[model samples]
Target: MSWTDERIEQLRSMWEKGLTASQIADELGGVSRNAVIGKAHRLGLKSRPSPVKATDAKLAKPAKSPAAPKPAAAPPRAAVPAAPRPAAPPPKPEPRPAVAAPPTPDGAAPVPKPDAPRIVSIGPGGFIRQGPGDQQAPIPPAPPRRLVPAKPSPEIADKTSLLDLNDRICRWPMGHPGEPDFHFCGEAVNPGFPYCVEHCGRAYQAQLPRGTRRPPPPPPFGGPRVR
Candidate 1:
């Protein structure tokens, strides 16, 4: 609610009389305590500190106790001379031996041979070799491996290549179209036949009368089956 002139004067009077925000709000109808507080703050109105209640004053003042006796004065400390520190132990001697002086340049140092591949203790009789070029101990060269040509199987090796065939491919469609697992037969077509040997068996069942057309044998294991 808007703070009318009458409400503003009433709020100021109530605040000066030590009335809380809630009490002021109750006095002025249609106004909340927060609204009253906000208007009071905007009007630069100051609130008086709350006076101590009767019960609070009684609890705040603690009862007095009897005076305690004073403690006796302590005696003065005696001065004592500090004992002399023990002499530091002698320095420890080094454990390592002194290095020997190098010989004069007139006596040249022995040169070390270049490092190469060396064989050590291959078999019994202590056959240790210093290097491959060492003539005294010789190792024989390994024999070359002979490779045999692999024979092709009649079933797979005889089949026509998919690359050599025309775009016809196998006519046998696997599952119905619009199906989740729909797929078509992709094998090369047999000569004079729409379906491959595998699909041929699936496309046409065995004849009822004496069979004139003998269907080709089913494809090998793991080959596609007729859906």
Candidate 2:
């Protein structure tokens, strides 16, 4: 693009001011970025003097000389009295009665219960491996053992609460869910003594008794044929 006279004048000043071609190109804009340098060379603009047109665009750069000392600044213009530093604004009045904050809360917000847990598949068979914090918790001291409730005995208090069946103590709270596969369908709870509503009902009939398994019946009491 052809350079405008004004642009050429600015270019001269920029060059005299020791600006690099890149700087001049930025100011001029639009022309091939290299146009500034080409035009200056074609027009015989001498940055220093002995320099011939640069052979390689890459090496066309000339080393910068120390900047010319700036002219002494003109004496500071007579001060016109800066509007009298606007009267130091009056200090903000102190609060009359500062609000007393409610006594700091006894403790900060309660710690949130951890999220249920995200199931992650890791093993080759896609077996789930829990993320960390697995053992951190000390198996919440299994809640106070609730007694397994017996069948809905007539004596049961609320038919709902197992303690009603028989004050029989349970290692675990009664009525709780039991192993999925073994839970019984017969009675919602075992009938005899106190039985775990969860475990007793479904226990193998022979093992129905609450405590340890009973000794085998004395070998089916042999026939007393000794008349």
Candidate 3:
């Protein structure tokens, strides 16, 4: 709305009286708070404190009164002595019969008690073996261990030459073909295998049933020990 002289004067007076822009807008009909503010700014009326800040200051809680000093603590009460407990009676000793020793001939000595049976450790895990007598019988020398001879490998001369190779014969190569000594295993092949019984044994190994396979032998003593 256009600001007439009358409305402008009213706005200046209201603004100077500490009225908010909204209040001035309501007082001057046909004008918005922004319009009133713009007119007041143009008129160069003295700027007033912000109504929001003034309301906040007025609404703010007053400083709390200093807390009252706490009262002094009461003195501790005296403890009363408890009545003494009666002492328990002492236990009576039990009666036991005296044992008498057997009589012996005047010059004879007393016989000694038999020795306790002794245990002999034979192996690991505290294995104990009782012998017929007080002492353990000597462990018989371990039966002499004999090494079983390994099956001799097929001789190179026994291997079949390329010219002699046949479908029924083992096709397992014995040696490098580039060498003059190269030959094929000439043994009879298993029905479905490409190699003979021995060659097949070396070629395709069957997995042993679980828990049936033997553990690898321990390394010999005096060698590097595995931690």
Candidate 4:
């Protein structure tokens, strides 16, 4: 619907007066709520918070009326004065026992012992302890670990094995042979490699860049050669 100058002014005024898009749309003839919203947005209108919805309790309550003023209460009676009481004398304080000081030669004062190393309380539920001198040479760092290459499993070479061997299963030894959990990778072999894509990458890490083009292997003697 076309927005005339009069309709646009009315829309701006109603929007400024806190009317919702639906209400503005209803007020403006031949306009939808979405249309009003779009026009308002294009006009860079500031958005107001949605008016609070009226609850059933509020809607059900009747409007309160002003009540008639009540007559002022009679003046309160004057209180009778109480008689003054005689003040009693304060009791004397008892004498405290004398402490015996350690006797030193020539009236020299006794020296206090050195305090033990303290654990100081820091921020919420935290504590800081005074460390012993040198603290055991700051714990020498561990040696750098070596990445040993995965060895081929001897079980893959044996033809009498019960485990069903496939051309796809990765034959690399996974962990230490002495460990109970030691196993071989059984993932599908990558094209032109004995290992899977992952193990092939690991096996040829220093040799080649990944995804490099390679010539296909020659076909078997009895099979037809592929171009």
| Predicted model with the maximum TM-score | 3
- Candidate 4, residue 218: CA error in Å? 64
Off by over 4 Å in 4: 52-227
Best by lDDT: 3
Pairs clashing within candidate 1? none
Evaluated against the true structure, the overall lDDT of model 4 is: 0.74
**Could you tell me how far off, in angstroms, the CA of residue 50 lies in candidate 3 after the best superposition?**
1.4
Q: By the TM-score metric, which is better: model 1 or model 3?
A: 3
Which residue ranges in model 3 land beyond 4 Å of their true spot?
Answer: 62-66, 73-227
Clashes of 2: 3
Which clashing pairs does model 4 show? Answer: none
Worst 10 contiguous positions by lDDT, candidate 4: 156-165
For lDDT, candidate 2 versus 4, the one ahead is 4
Give the C-alpha lDDT of model 2.
0.61
Cα RMSD to the true fold for all candidates: 24.2, 28.4, 25.1, 31.8
Model 1 clash tally, residue pairs: 0
**What does candidate 1 score on TM?**
0.25
**Better candidate by lDDT, 1 or 3:** 3
C-alpha lDDT (0 to 100) for residue 73 of candidate 3? 100
Q: TM-score each candidate.
A: 0.25, 0.21, 0.30, 0.23
Give the Å error, residue 142, model 2. Answer: 99
